[model samples]
Structure formats: C-alpha cells, structure tokens
Target chain A: MTGIEPLAVAAAGLMGIGLYGFCLCRHAVRRLLSINLFGNGVFLALILIARRLPDGPDPVPHAMVLTGIVIAVSATAFGLALVRRQARTRGDDET
Target chain B: MTALDSLLALLLLLLAARCVSARSLLQAIVAFIVLGLLLALSWVRLEAPDLALAEAAIGAGLLGVLLLGTWRSLPLGHGNERIPLPWQGLRPALITTGCTVLAVLLTVALHQHPEQAAMSGLAALDQLDAAGVDQPVTAVLLNFRAYDTLLEMGVLLMALIGTLMLDSPLPRDTELPARTMLPATLAQLFLPLILLIGLYLVWAGAYSPGGAFQGGAVLAGAGVLLILTGFGEGDGRDGWVLRALLAGGALVFTLAGLLLIPVTGAFMAYPQGLVTPIMVLIEFSLALSIALSLLLLYTGTPGLRRRGER
Candidate 1:
C-alpha cells in the first residue's frame, strides 16, 4: 500500500473515535471536541483523497477543506456559546 | 517519503486516540490541540501548503485559543470528568464490534477500488488564467467556486452575531483583573511582528500558498494576544467600525456579485480584465472580517472596552 492509505485509515479511525466519544462523553465540552474531531477526520479524508492528481494535489479539495476549517471554527464558537449559556443557567438555578 | 507518511499517520492516530481517551478535560484539550498541529503537518505532507497554513493557523492556533477560553469560562467541576460512554455493558461491546467490522470492510474496499475518477481540479485549472488568481487554491476559492467562499463569510458573520446574542461575554471590564496572563513587554515586542507577518501572508496569497483565511487567522492570533494582555479595543458593541469589520467579508462579496451581475452576465464573475483587482478587494475585506470575527468568537463578546474606560 502507498503512504496515502495509512493516512486515510488514521482519519477513519479518528471518525470512529469521534463517534464513540460524541455519544458517550458526559461533558458538553468533550462532546464538542469529539464533534470537531469528527469534522477534522472528514476534512482529512477529503484532503488525502485529493492527492491522487498528477500535476499537483487538486486545488478544489484544498479550497473546500480551507472553507471547512473556517466553518468548523464558526460552528464550534456557536456551540461553545450555547454550552456556556446553558452551564451558567444551570449554575444559577442550582443556587 | 513513505517513511515520513507512515510516521505522521502513526502519530496522528496515537495523538487522536489520546485526545479522545485522556482522563481529564484539560489533558484532552491539550492533546486535541497537539493533534491539530500534527494534522497540519499531515496537510503539508499531502502537498497542500495552503491548507497547512490554514490548519496550523485557524485549526490549531485560533481554535486552540478558543477552546481554552471556553474551558476557563465553564463553571468548576463541569468539564473535568473522564466521563464514560453512555453505554452499559453490552452496548459498548456492540459498538466496538460494529465499528471494527465497518472499518475493516471499508479499508478493504478502499484498497481494492481503482483510483480513476473525475475529481481532480485539472479541468478547472486549465481555465486558471480566467480565474484572476495565480495560486490554484486561491483561484478556485475566489473565482471558480466563489459561491462557497461567499457563503462561508455569511456563516462567519452569523456566528459572531449568535455569540454576541448569547450573553454578556468576558467578565465585565471592571471585574476583569489587570494583566491576565502574557506580559506587557512580550506583547509590545511580538504583536507588531505578528501583524506584519499577517499582512505579508495576505499579500503573498495571490501567487503563492497563502491567502485570506491563513492571513486572517494570523491576525486573529495577534488580536488574541492583545486581549490576553489586556490592551485590545475589541469592544464592538457601539463601534460601527467594528460592526462593519465583522460584516465586511459578506458585504463585499455579496455587493460585488450583485452589482456586477448584469455587467458580467453571471453572479460573482469578474469582467474581462477586472478580476484581479476585484479579487484582491474581496480577499482583503474577507481577511479583515475573518480576523475580527474570529477574535469576537474567542472573546465571545459583541464589544470589549478597556478595563479603566468609562
């Protein structure tokens, strides 16, 4: 097998780990981390697959992964905001 | 080449597993950040320097800062658990078994499948001259598949707005203690240099493996440094300038696409010779917006006033 296959497999392993963590993790922050990990796996797969080109790696997936990284951060920020507010509310209610 | 690839693949897997399985949240987050850096390295290995820049900057740098900030904001004891999977005895076993089977099957299929497909950017690259950018990724992002970039800017803007609306972010200025973490001397020395590099990255983007996102992330790192050092004027609440900066990318891309639609005969298509300047303008605005938007996300506030300011 070529070098690319191992990277792909690692990425796939990350996806499985993310899936397990996302479902099982008790902490909201951990869940978010898992989600981001899963997203990273998908992005990595897209990128590694782009290596099949001859002239150079394909630019399309590179661009898409760039966009994906930015979008992933945005989603993470939003989710963190939601989690922060929820945690605050929960703290307040307990008091 | 194969050795390096194998090493990266192994390191990524191990770091990722540690990130997922670390006993504490802090360790997990640290591991995740390291994983991001390693992933950036893998992106480089894949021969995409543009992505490497972005992954290292936005993915590892900016995102790491944000996650750490989030960790700080959460109430104590909430994020510290090693929390097990929600599954009881049989369920965990079932999941492991299922995942292993699927993974094995997929790996086999991937090995057997032929590599022929129509997914390469070669066809689009043949038209790169018309795309108005010298870098293939930039050409693809700013011209060929520009709609995605435009909408991504929209997503960023929405994120900022949503974060602002969530709650009062950051401790009230008066409540914030002076000298949070980084020393003043360090910030004074490094901030300017960071900003210079950020600008250089943006400028180099046209013909090189740098661009708006990577440059924006570098600038956001600068902003994060300023905020941590307690000297930043990130307060965006009333500053129309800040508001404008936050919205600039989407506004520029949409307006350019709309106003030129009739002239260019297609939305976002630059005219015969105007593509260069237009793309530059769009990218400049986009970078600035991304920087500000990311900083806002990091601070989780619509505005940040100086501690002593009224």
Candidate 2:
C-alpha cells in the first residue's frame, strides 16, 4: 500500500467505528462524541487527498478544510445546546 | 515512506479507534483530543500548516474543553448501557465486507487516475505573490475565494443564534459556584501567557499558519476557564454590546465588502494597495466573534458578564 492509501483506509476504518459507536451508544453525549469521531474521519480523508496534490499542496482544499473545521465546531456547539435542552426538559418531566 | 509519516498515521488510527471505543466518556474525550492532535500532525505531513494550527487549536483544544464541560453537566451513569447489535451475527460480517469493497474501489480509482490539475488553484498560485500574502492558504481563503469565507462567517453566526434560541434563559448568577474545584493556581499563572500567544497567532496569520479561527478558539478557552473557576458568569443577557460583538465580524466583513462594490466594482474587492489591511481587519473581527460565540455556546447562555453583576 502507498503512503496516502493507508491513511485513507485508516480514516475509512475510523468512520466505520464511529458509525458503530453511534448505533450502539444511547447517551446523547456519547452519541455526540461518536459523531465528532465521524467528522475527524472525514477530515482525515480530506487531508489525505490534500497530500496527494501535485507540485505545491493544493491551497483550495486546505482553505476548504479550514472552513470545514470552523463549521464542524459550530455544529457541535449547536448539538451540545440541543442535548442540554433535552436533558433539562427530561429532568423537569421526571421530577 | 518516511518513518515519521508512518508512525503518525498509525498513532492517528489507534487514537481514532480508541476515541469511539473507550467505555468511559472521559476516556473517549481524551482520546478524541489526542486524535485531533495526531490529525494536526498528519496535516503537517501533508504540507498544510494552516490546517495543522486550526486542527490543534479549534479541533483539539477548544472542542476538548467543550466536550469535557458537557460531560461534567450530565448526570453520571446515565449512558452506560451498550445496545446489542441488532442482527447479532450477520451484521458485522456484512459491514466489513461492504467496507472492504468500498475501500478497494477507492484505492483503485485513486491509483489509476490521479486528480485533474486544479486550474484555478494553479492560477491562484501564480498570482499569490501579487496578493501580498506569504501564505497561500490565507490568500486563497481571503483573497481568491473570499465569498466562501464571508458565507462561512454567516453560518457560524447562524449556528450561534440557533444555539441561543434553543437554550433556556441564563440562571440568575449563572456563574459556576466555587464548589470543590481543582487547584487553578497554574491556570491563573498561565492565563496571560496563553492570551499573549493567542494574540500573536492572530497577528502572525497573515504570514504564517496561525489565524483567526485558532486564535479565537484559544481565547474562548480562556473565557471557559474563567467561567469554570467562578471568576465570571453568564450574566450578560441584557448587554447589547456583547451581542453586537458576537455578530460584529460578519456584519463588518459584509459591510466592508459591500462598501467596496462602488469603488472596486466588486464585492469584497479591496481598493488597490489595501488588501492586506482589509484582510487583517476582517480576521480580527472574525477572531472576536468566533471566541465570543464559542464561549457563549459553552456557557449555554445568551451572553456573559462580570461576576456579581446584575
């Protein structure tokens, strides 16, 4: 296997593991972690592709991935808010 | 074929697996942070230092704190049960087979026909020197395709707004109480140093890998630490100024870009000889907005204020 290919495979494996974790984890927090794992896996794939660009490294993909990181964190923050709200409402209901 | 690349890739894979597989949420969060660090290393290997800095700061550091804070607030032993696989025996095999086939196809395709040359990127590379920025990624992000960056700033603002809408009003005295907390002496000693580094990163972004996003995340970490240690609280709900700062980056960037339409005949087009200054302006605003947004997200409140305030 070539250098980039292995990284790609490993990233794909990470994606699979994240998917499995998401499927089996019931806790919303754990599920969030799993979803983040999935995101990192996609990021890994993008970096792998970035490595393969001929001549100078592809700046476009690098820029896109940087944007992607910001978007991912924003989304994760939003997801955390949703989780907290659900937990709070559930607790209120239980009490 | 370098040993460093192989070792880093191996470490990344192991950490990625552990992040998902760890039984303890704390362990998983730690592993996830490590995974992000290793991923940063991978980006460095790929010759993407801009991404490396971003992955380390935002991906590993700020996100790690957010995850840990959320874990702290959740009730203990709430998510301990692991669900059994639905198909019992056949599912694992099927998944493995499907994955293997997909991997093979991808590998074959990548090996057979490499990606076509990015024509615009090549053009950008040719004109990079004229853009007055030493870093290609920054030039691309702000100069070559600034519309995307502008839109991304909008997405970030929208996300923060969405989160605020979903969260309940901040508790009176929403600052965390000083209950059995870790010794924060070290944090106090290091806070100024970290803030200095964050500012340096933002300033250096024009020429190097460090930029607004990473610096903003570091700044947010500082705010998070202050909140955790009972030094401050999420009490800025009535502070319209705080909300404006949170929205300032996008608004300023958009307005500045629009203002250029008449003079430059294009949105976001800087007047000749002023591109770098314009970029710096946009970046600083972005850093403030991003930091405030992330801090507010963690606080789970509309805003924050000084401790003991109304």
* Off by more than 4 A, model 2: A1-4, A53-55, B83-88, B107-116, B168-183
Taken over the whole model, the C-alpha lDDT of each candidate is 0.81, 0.75
lDDT (tens digit, per residue) of candidate 2 on B191-302: 8988888787788877887778778877888887776666677753647788789888888888888888999997777887888888888888888988898888777778
How many backbone overlaps does candidate 2 show?
A: 0
Best by DockQ: 1
Every model's Cα RMSD, please? 2.4, 3.1
Index of the highest-lDDT prediction: 1
lDDT of 1 by residue, B1-310 (tens): 7778778878887877677778778788898999999998988878887888898888888888777777777776567766454355677667766765765665555455455743548876788888888899999899899999999998998988888888746443445555654475688889999999998888788899999999999999898888777776556455888788888888999999999989989878889889899999989999999998998888887876764565
Candidate 2 lDDT over A1-95, as tens digits, reads 34455666667666666776676677777787778777777777776665545677867777888889999888887887777677778888999
Worst 10 residues of 1 chain B by lDDT: B168-177
- Misplaced by over 4 Å in model 1 are A1-4, B83-88, B109-120, B168-182, B233-236
Query: What CAPRI grade goes to candidate 1?
Result: medium
State the lDDT of candidate 1 residue by residue for A25-83, as single tens digits.
77888888988888888888878767666777778888889999999999888888888
